[model samples]
Target: MAILATGQPNLEAGQSQSLHYDDFPPLNSCSKLKIGTPRLPIVPSLPNERECKIGLLRNRHVLIGLELQEDFINVMAKNIYYLLAKDGYLYTMKPLIYDAKFKVEEETTLTMAWISFPDLKPTFFVKESIFSLATAVGKPIHLDMATINKTRPSCARVKFQVDLLANFPKFMEMETVNEDTKETKIERVKIHYDRLPRYCLHCKVQGHAEEECRSIHPELHQYVARD
Candidate 1:
């Protein structure tokens, strides 16, 4: 049902070349579709390869004949596990079914899932919880602090704030107390400035006031001198 574009001339465009599914034999199984046929050596019969391909296509809702690497297939299974693991029923049910049905290599798939945790931010809570449970049950986990920090702010915030406070209460001032004390005595004081002399004001000096000035005002000086 899927059409793959081969980037060749179309017969409808009068180039006398067209390629379609009809032109080629139906691949009886996905194993028959090999990668790098002549350039690289052909892959020997990959056990469960067809089931893997079918499972990927079905679970991911992707078209068949989409070229996929082994690593990509592994990653896809892990991602699916991460996405579905939070759903209680799906977590318990689907992985077992998926594992049994697809025959996914557990160590490889779980490792792939763990590595993929950083990329799947939306499912970080579920992934982290699952990881914690696994670690509690004595499963070895390679914790990526940077990846977890990058993905989950809530977890990071709780780690930096609450856990740190719990571990180092003195440093965080968690139990410190503040007390208020009473004061008994009070006093008041007045402030004063030294008085200035009068005549020095007419000469524009700092020690004098204006009222008793010896230097005449300009209008007064003019009238007095005229007199």
Candidate 2:
């Protein structure tokens, strides 16, 4: 359940969507995956739509109805997938579970991204341990194949749900104690994001950063500066 929004051409207001379930293609199939993306003549460089299982799924302009897989339901609940579509950006892909209760214009703070923890101990590379470490940032979704199989010992990469509004910490401290001596030492794990979405601290939105948003809120900026 997601409400498709756009920066190029905002979604039309008062547009209503219908919900329908078909008895085909297996139960809980991702339905909106098939909806023909209405052509955007302005965004000429946009690529043709294809099957996409990853969260990079992008759409814009029109309101769309979706029936998502169970695996994706919770993950999409409070997330926005910000993207750059060839010539320009598509702005957002905000999911509509709880947001349905509020005005759809409100932006969600959490967005999905892959983050890496470098030089973590081998024991901590397991899914449970990695997920535990990931909580310092956000909820962990899935682990990369390399991390799962220990093919990549250098670091552990995971798809995570992170709060865009929160100030991100560069490193996490872990206390490790020797089994016999009980001597504890603090270990630091570095956090690296594969991609960071553009978020405006001024507008509290995902579309753009505060510098680009000063035009819209010049008076507000001036007021803050005086303080």
Best by lDDT: 2
In model 1, which range of ten residues has the least summed lDDT? Answer: 164-173
Q: How close is candidate 2 to the true structure, as a TM-score?
A: 0.54
Estimate TM-scores for all models.
0.15, 0.54
Poorly placed runs, candidate 2 (over 4 Å): 1-102, 201-204, 217-227
Q: Which candidate achieves the best TM-score against the true structure? A: 2
Clash list (residue pairs), candidate 2? none
Model 2, 1-227: lDDT tens per residue?
Answer: 21122311111111122223342221111112122333332221112242223222243322322334333434343343333344453444444322232223444555667889886867667766676667677767678889999998998998876777765666766655565675667566677887667787666656688767876757656543563
Q: Tens-digit lDDT track for model 1 on 1-227? A: 11112321111111122222222222112111111112111222222354333322232222123233332333223212221211222221122112222322211111112222221223333323323322211222333455444554332111110110111111100011122332222111111111211223245432233543446544434343563
Off by over 4 Å in 1: 1-133, 137-147, 155-227
Write down the lDDT that model 1 would get. Answer: 0.24
Alpha-carbon RMSD of each model? 39.2, 15.3
How far residue 50's Cα lies from its native spot in candidate 2, in Å, is: 16
